[model samples]
Target: MSTPLSLDRIQHAPKALLHDHLDGGLRPATVLELADQFGYDDLPATELDALTEFFRTAAHSGSLERYLEPFAHTVGVMQTAEALHRVAYECVEDLAADNVVYAEIRFAPELHIDGGLSLDEVVDAVLAGFVDGERAAAGTGRAITVRCLVTAMRHAARSREIAELAIRFRDRGVVGFDIAGAEAGYPPTRHLDAFEYMRGNNARFTIHAGEAFGLPSIHEAIAFCGADRLGHGVRIVDDITVDEDGTAKLGRLASILRDKRIPLEMCPTSNVQTGAAASIAEHPFDKLARLRFRVTVNTDNRLISDTSMSQEMARLVEAFGYGWSDLERFTINAMKSAFIPFPERLAIIDDVIKPRYAVLVG
Candidate 1:
């Protein structure tokens, strides 16, 4: 018998996450304690409820720029290595408990340097946390493997430098490099050298595109920067049109994306909160999935969006009436698109994901 497609049940199915942010998933109490410990008293709220509401409110302002405003506090408290380690460890614990077996959590190393640590020190601290988190989660019988995707803020000029940093630690928990920030003016093409550097080093990367911006951003990320994957490529829907009979037509760009099988890291909750999609009901995930686009579900910022992998899948089930098989397909899509080596990705898929999902998708 098949398991019901409920949120609680969904947590038992192994999942792979690719687009989550490290700083954005901090627990409210962690933020508060870190702030108090570090003498950074600029938080807008002292209590948990008020702080949680503050983040949710900022995220729901329907503006990408505004949605990112709450990160100042989380990143502010995370300057020291101890804070980064704590945040990274907790992020794994939360994801592991949510049944995320494999995750590539991302953060900007440059942002943490404001606390007086070097960029290398920042990366080392986070990696150490991930190693410890993996061990602890395994001890708890969850068995999660967490990797890092060092991010370069799109508005900054350190893209090349950060790309190099990702390469230096590629053997460690760091598997990939990424560029993220407000997408209004800072297009991915601005960081061509960084992407080129990754490519030159035979590294993989995904670009933040088609989220707040449009196809132009997507175009540059793919065509110019050679992004291995797209971060929130939801806006590719702009190039598509559906007929009255439900037949969908794909534009050239969309056709290329589909034909190339480039992964679209679609974060539904974060997309809605950031106005990338008007609401969950109107998200293009269903249409894109039906069209055979390499669409994968993700939680861009779990704490900010108040979401988890289970919550993301459950919301899809609620909105589009998806079933367990649908969730399995999305999970497999993420694993297939993971930046890990082909053998490693396949091992997890065949051993962990397929077997666990076989029971849920019975």
Candidate 2:
């Protein structure tokens, strides 16, 4: 194999992001603009630079609840349809600029209901924004597809309702369903009705598990809830045991994951920011990859984690000595796990993602 490629070039490489929070990835300038337009005076800082620093500090505090405060600011300004459109448009533009070929951005529609918009209306606004974004990016000669993953806040009792909303928008732009928020108190089984409904409809869904919680959460999400993929399933590392002679024995749970081909949407920076992992060096990504688990890299929250797909890939390269082939594998893993239809997913891999990566590593 050739010498490992540099991180900077990875920024130009095509990437697939299967896990990212729509509200968590807003631009700071957009937040300021929306806050100003709505006369919402709750901003911790008024100046752009200060506001950026405020978000960074909050996310770096290593508290999940504190890290989520910026969303309150972003969501506060996104009540109006126009504001939601702008944020969604900008999100696509930013990701396209970062060379993300395909991304599944997720958020809870119920959160935007506080702005006096119904769940369907909120979905329409975001979908309209995505259409505008795709058109704009096409003019710039960049192809980026943004799919929505309707998230139901786990603590709230709206999972089944949100699942129906996701199905409603399936033909329009929404791709899948997800359960997000505090993982400890709100187990995936709590929203069993929604998962069952999605399963019956043959719809795709993922669950946020093993991030702030442990293996049981992941277990319930997969075994009980039938998660098509796992969101931040980093805690599966807890089930791995290493012997003095370097022999690794995966626990029964880990074995099931490997055997069943469950994809782990591992976000290194976000894991560190949320205290899921002690540090990037200690992240289980390398171990998981080595064990041949269906591992894919992602920027869970681009704004809060201060990460892009390239940055996440670069970190893995440096930390685990990954090369071009490894990066290619990661991208393929994401493509395989995407909730899109089989033909469309294959088209993206064959016609777009693979061709781009071929030139990079050739």
How close is every model to the real structure, measured as TM-score?
0.98, 0.98
Worst 10 residues of 1 by lDDT: 1-10
Question: Model 1: per-residue lDDT, tens digit, 148-245?
Answer: 99999999999999999999999988899999999988988899899999999999999999999999999999888999999999999999999999
Candidate 1 error regions (>4 Å): 1-4
How many residue pairs clash in all the candidates, one count each? 0, 0
Q: In candidate 2, how many Å is residue 15 off?
A: 0.4
Instruction: Write down the TM-score for model 2.
Output: 0.98
Q: Give model 1's TM-score versus the native structure.
A: 0.98
> Clashing pairs in model 2?
none
- Please report the candidate that would top lDDT against the real structure: 1
User: What value does the lDDT take at residue 133 in candidate 2?
Assistant: 95
lDDT of 2 by residue, 1-362 (tens): 45666777898898999999888889999999898988878989999999998877788867667667678887888887888899899989999998888999998899997778899999999999988998898799888888999999999999999999988899999999999887878899999999999988889999999999999999999899999999989999899999999899999989998999999999999898888988888899998999999999999888888888989998888787888888988998999999988898899999988888889887
